[model samples]
Target: MSFIASIGQGAINLYHRIRWVVSISTAIVQLAFHPSSWTKPVRAVLTRQIVFTGYDAIGFVAVVALLTGISVVVQAQVWMGRLGQSELLGPLLVTVIVREVGPLLVNFIVIGRSATAMAAELAGMKVRHEVEVLDSQGLDPLVFLVMPRAISMALSVFGLAMLFVVFSFGSGYLCGAFLGTGPGDPGIFARSVVRGVSSYDFYNILAKTLIPGLLTGVIAANEGLSVEGVATDIPQAVTRTVVRATLAVLVVSVIVSVLTYI
Candidate 1:
C-alpha cells in the first residue's frame, strides 16, 4: 500500500507540473499578441534576450554544425557513391540534417547554454525579492519578465536552426570535396540539396524550432519563479528547468515528426 501510494503521488505531481507549464505557455502566447505587452522595457528585455541567447551562440553553434556536417555529410557521400546511388545523397542529407538533426541539436544546445542561465538568473531574482519589488511597483512580472524572454527564445531558436542548416551543409560540402568523396562540381552538390528540399521541410524546421523554443523558455521561467524566498532552492530550480525543458523539447519534436508522417 505504501509503495502504491508513493507512485500515485508522483503521478499527481507530474500531472500538476504539466498543467502549470501548459497554463503558463498559453498565457505567454496570448500576451505575445497584445500590442500593449511590447512596452519599451519589454522591448529592451526582448532585445537583450535575443542577443544573449541567439547572437552570442553563433560561434559555438557554427562549430558544432561544421563538425556534424563533416562527419554525416562525408559519410553519406562516400556510402552513396559506393552503392552507385549518389543521386540519393541530397535527399538523405536533407532528411537527416534539416528534418531531424538540425533543430534537435540546436534546441539541446540552447537548453544547456541559455536556458540554464535564464533559470538561474530568474531564480536569483526570486530569492532577492526583486520580483516582488517589480510587482509592487505596478510592473507585471509576466510582461516585463516572462513574455519577452519566451518570445525572444522562439525567434532565436528559429534563426539559429536556419544558420545551423546552412553551416552544416557548407562545411559538409567543403570537407567532402577536399576528401574527394563528393562531386567535383560545387553546383551539383548545391542542386542535390535543393532538390531534396520540399515545402514540408520548411514547415518541419519551423515547428521543431519555434514551438520547442517557446516551451523551453516558459519552462525555465516557470521553474525559476517557482522558487521560494529560500536561496538554497535556486540550484534545484535551475536543475528542474534543464530537465523539464529538455523533456518538453523532445516531446514537441516527436509530436511534430509524427504529424509530418501522418
Candidate 2:
C-alpha cells in the first residue's frame, strides 16, 4: 500500500508541475503580444537572449547539421540508389530532416546549451534575491525577466531550425555528390528536394519548433524560479530544467507528428 501511495503522490506532483508550466507558457505568450510589454529594457534583454541562444550557437549548430547531413542524407541517397528508388530520395530526406530531425535536433541543442544556462542564471538571481530587488524597483519579474527570455527562446529555436534544415541539406548534397551517392547534378538534386516539399511540411515544422520552444522556455524559467533562495538548490533547478524541457520537446514533437497525419 505504501508503494502504491508513493506512486500516486508522484503522479499528482507531475500533473501539478505540468499544469503550472502550461499556465506560465500561456501567460508568456499573452504578455509577448501586448504592445506595452516592449519596454526598452525588455527589448534589450530580448536582443541579448537572441544573441546568446541563436547567433552565438550558429557555428556549433552548423557543425552538427553538417555531420548529420553527411550521415543521414548520404545514407538515404545510397540506399535509395541501391533500391532503384532514387526518385524517393527527396521525399525521404524531407521527411527525415525537415519534418523531424531538424526541429528536434535544434530544440535539443538549444535546451542543452541555452536553456540550461538560462535556468542557472535565473536560479542564481533568485538565490541572490535579485528578483526581489527588481520587484522592489517596481519591476514585475515576469515581465522584466521571464517574458523576454521566453519569447527570445521561441524565436531563436525557429530561426536555428530553419538554418539547420538549409545547412543539413546543402552538406548532404555536397557529400552525396562527392561520394557518387547522389544524382551528381546540382539542378536535379535541387529540383528533387523542392518537389518533395509541401505546405503541410511548412506547418509541421512551425508547430514543432515554436510550440515546443515556448514550452521549453517556460519549463526552464519555472524551475529556476522555484528555487527557494538556497544556493545548493540552484544545481537541482538546472537539472530539472534540462529534464523537463527535453520531455516537453519530445511530447510536443510526437503530438505535432500525429496531428500532421490526422
Task: Estimate TM-scores for all models.
Answer: 0.97, 0.98
**lDDT (tens digit, per residue) of candidate 2 on 9-29:** 999999998888888888988
What is the TM-score of candidate 2?
A: 0.98
The list of candidate 2 runs beyond 4 A from truth reads none
Using lDDT as the measure, the top candidate is: 1
* Candidate 1, 1-262: lDDT as tens digits: 9999999999999999889878988999999999988888889999999999999999999999999999999999999999999999999999999999999999999999999999999999999999999999988999898999988899999999999999999999999999899986999999999999999999999999999999999999988898999999988998998889999999999998898888
